[model samples]
Target chain A: MKSSIEVHNLTTAYGGAPVLWDIDFQLPTGQIIGIIGPNGSGKTTLLKTIMGLLDPASGFVKVFDQPLDKVREKVAYVPQRESVDWDFPASVYDVVMMGRYRKYNLFKRTKDPDREIVLQSIEKVGLSEFKDRQISRLSGGQQQRVFVARALAQGADLYLMDEPFVGVDAATENSILNLLSEMKNEGKTVVIIHHDLQTVSDYFDYLLLLNTRLIARGTPAEVLTKENLTNAYGGQLTLLSKVVNLIKQNEFPIREKDSDV
Target chain B: MNDFWIILTASLVAINSALLGSFLVLRKMSMIGDAISHAVLPGIVVAYYFSEDKASIFLLLGATLTGVLTSLIIDFLSKKAKIQGDASIGITYTLLFAVGMIMISGWMQGNVDIDLDCVLYGDIALVNMDKVIVDGNLYVGPRAFYIEFLGFAIIGFCLWIGFKGFKLLSFNEDYARSLGIATGRWHYFLMGLVSLTTVVSFEVVGAVLVVGFLIIPAATAQLMTDKLKPMLLYACGFGILAVIIGYFTAVYFDVSITGSMVSVSTLIFLAITVLKRRKRQTKALLKSSTDLRG
Candidate 1:
């Protein structure tokens, strides 16, 4: 399998405090990959580093065997929903149209084919009716779908999402999951920073268990071992029940809507 | 003729600042407009000394550099030196403005044209006397008029070409960077525009009053709309209206023209804010009465 991302000894810091320490991973392509860890575990930091939004303090990261700048057009990023001001005066179509902008066509008018792609991306995320609606009027699930649609409009092969599932309804989650599966089927790679341990196995084929360092990286079943959990999760017993279910190895744990972190 | 020139010059100054101020307000950097206006005072003093002309292109360039410098210092102090954003801004502008003040009183003491009082309140009444000479005898127009007209053309062209990049930068800078856009280029380009607008409008509205023109009309429009395009349009319109109304009011009352204009803009802003709140309350009351009926 060709490598989608190769992080060789990446150490990133915010201000002076180093968050990620010597994270090394060469994730395979055409897989739904999840980066799982506790809060403040540098999951978002690593994702930002991969997106080239944050400069790593030490070591380097290569996407598709080249630097991020060399393959920037091939990458799409969906920031956390709370990262932007929801009250910003932009409609759903206006926000998604940002994806169609390129260096050559930035100053030119929005063409017909670009509009078609934006509409198709909106439809894929099930937001065709609310295309002209202002973003502030949308519900939490619909807001998340808007970001997904924007990323889809990029038509990039690699999608990097930061906690895309937080505060969204189950229906939105399933639809987004189906969309991710379809993307994977079309030979694209997706990397997500996820919080829900219950849906870990079902949502991702590749898992990167992280806690300031790369704890383990492989198939979800291979990476979710007891030893790996203890190393990354150190005294975080709140997730023990889900860990116990994984330890039992009987079946995949069903998602409890109320218990999501 | 003086009345027409004063009103035209003031309207031009108002619209120029309002157009750029729309972006500044949307970025939640309205205070930056205030900061940049004051911070460019020293640049104006320095450029005036070298060029010996207020409307010299060299002075515009020098002041724009200072404005961009102010932005860089604020970003550096906040991001690198770990100072709070408001503190850094306050520190930078006051320091630069004081330097400009010292240059005026210390060296340019006999120079009454660039006096501190004139720098603050400006002399719109005298703009008609300061004419642009074509061949040393033929007068063209007021210096402020030409300055603001050229500023308008430059600002309008940049806004047209950079509509996409600037919009993305205002909305989500990180997402814009992810699309291979150079966000730093747009950020500095905007800083440059703010600088240019403030420097040119200085002769018309003065340093402090330029911020009034920059923030008031844009803020007033913002209180009434939830879209960028209409907010900008309304801001430009409100600015012209304030210039016209304030021009007449100043003549009628024998008051300061620039002061009255900004004052009128504030009144408009306050009136709209109160009206919007009243409408919201009425809607809520109607909804409750309907709920009771149901």
Candidate 2:
């Protein structure tokens, strides 16, 4: 079990307050790992620190047994859909082509093979018809797909995503999960920051419950214990019950599907 | 010859502004250009008071330093002190601008050519009078021509080489950084470009209206096109067109050249906005008529 990410004693702060303090964990390679936490629980901060987008104040983050710069090309990140200005004047193809660009090819234009990869990435996400359409005209789900396509085009071994399913349609979410599973089958690792605890078992093979600190890390069944939920959620009744219900459904296995309520 | 120099100088300002201003506008730092332009005045006044020479190149050095400081102060206040971004910009520029105003008022009663009115609105028509005399007396073109052209050439070369880097930085900074590109370096490099451009353009449009040259044409081009490349080219074309119209308008009406140029740029922006509004209404009307027939 090769380690994909090893964060040790990492403390990242914005200015005065530390968002993530003394976070220590190692995620295994070739697994869909979800970092679940409430809002402002430093979920995004952890991903950013691992991607070397933020400087950790007190500790270090290692990727692939080396520093981030040494293995940056092997990592692809999909920032939150809300983080970017959707109104920017770029077509789907233009935006997807940004991932095909590496530091070595900064001065050179895209070659024919890279062009084919960009188009194939676009098609993989079912956006081939809207390749030339301006990104601002895209629906939220389509825009989310565009970002996934960008991350996919990087052809990286490790993918870090911040809330990729937020505000996406059912079909888009399903397609992205399928796409991510395909990547996992190819022996790539994906670490994602996700909300909605109900689907943790369905979506991720491994789980990390974060609350400015590492609360738990293991398989979904091991980490989703009632004791761990209460510890992480801090007596939040709604979230505790949601996980309780998830555990109940996992045991009973009677419902055909999760229909309304 | 005088008319050619004035229009050419203004066009150069237009081109320089568009080269860097497009990125600024997209980055949502358009007002920083306005703020830095206004804040460089104290540097100009202080440089003149110390050197006692208005033509000294140190005036540019002093003002450029002040322009860069204005942005740094804004960044410090907004990022470190928990201050709101807009309030930080407003606070930084006003303080520096007032300092410049105080310096100019005291120097105005003395035997100095640096006055408040001239600082606010520069006189571009006197460009021909400031000729660069070569080694012992061969008269070259206007000195402003050299400064403005140097600014344009340097900006063009940097943007051409770093186009992909800048494009990624402007569109998605986080993704760029994750790719191991130093986003902080490109950000400050652009700020330095904007600072240098503001200093060179400060003489032509003055401390107050330099933002007009940097912002208005880029904004107008943004309205005319959605793509960045076309936006840049359209900005250049719109700026040159504005210079021609504004130069002729100034000559016929006997007004300020810089004033007329900015006013013309603003007018073009307004005209396009109105045309776009009407086009939207027409599209809606056509859709409604077809729906009614069905």
**A-chain TM-score in candidate 2?**
0.90
Q: Write the per-residue lDDT of candidate 2 for residues A98-217, one digit (tens) a residue.
A: 998787887787799988999999999999999999899999999999998999889899999888898899989988999988998999999988999999999999999999999999
lDDT of 1 by residue, B90-129 (tens): 9999999998899988977676357777777788888998
lDDT for residue A62 in candidate 2, whole number 0-100: 87
Off by over 4 Å in 2: A239-261, B42-62, B98-113, B132-140, B292-294
Tens-place lDDT digits, model 2, residues B1-294: 788888989899888887788888888899998888888878877777778755566876787788888888998998789798899999999999998887777645474567777677876888788887899788778888888888888888888888888889989998998888877778877877787787787777777777887788888888887787888888888888888899999999999888898899889989989999999999999999999999
* Native contacts recovered, each model: 0.68, 0.68
| Model 1 misplacement above 4 A | A238-261, B108-113, B133-140
Q: Score the docking of each candidate (DockQ).
A: 0.60, 0.60
**lDDT score for residue A111 of model 2:** 96
- Point out the worst 10-residue segment of candidate 2 chain B by lDDT: B106-115
Candidate No. with top TM-score = 1
Task: Please write out the lDDT profile of model 1 over residues A29-107, one tens digit for every residue.
Answer: 9999999997568888888888878899999999999998899889999998977887777899999999898766778
lDDT of each: 0.89, 0.85
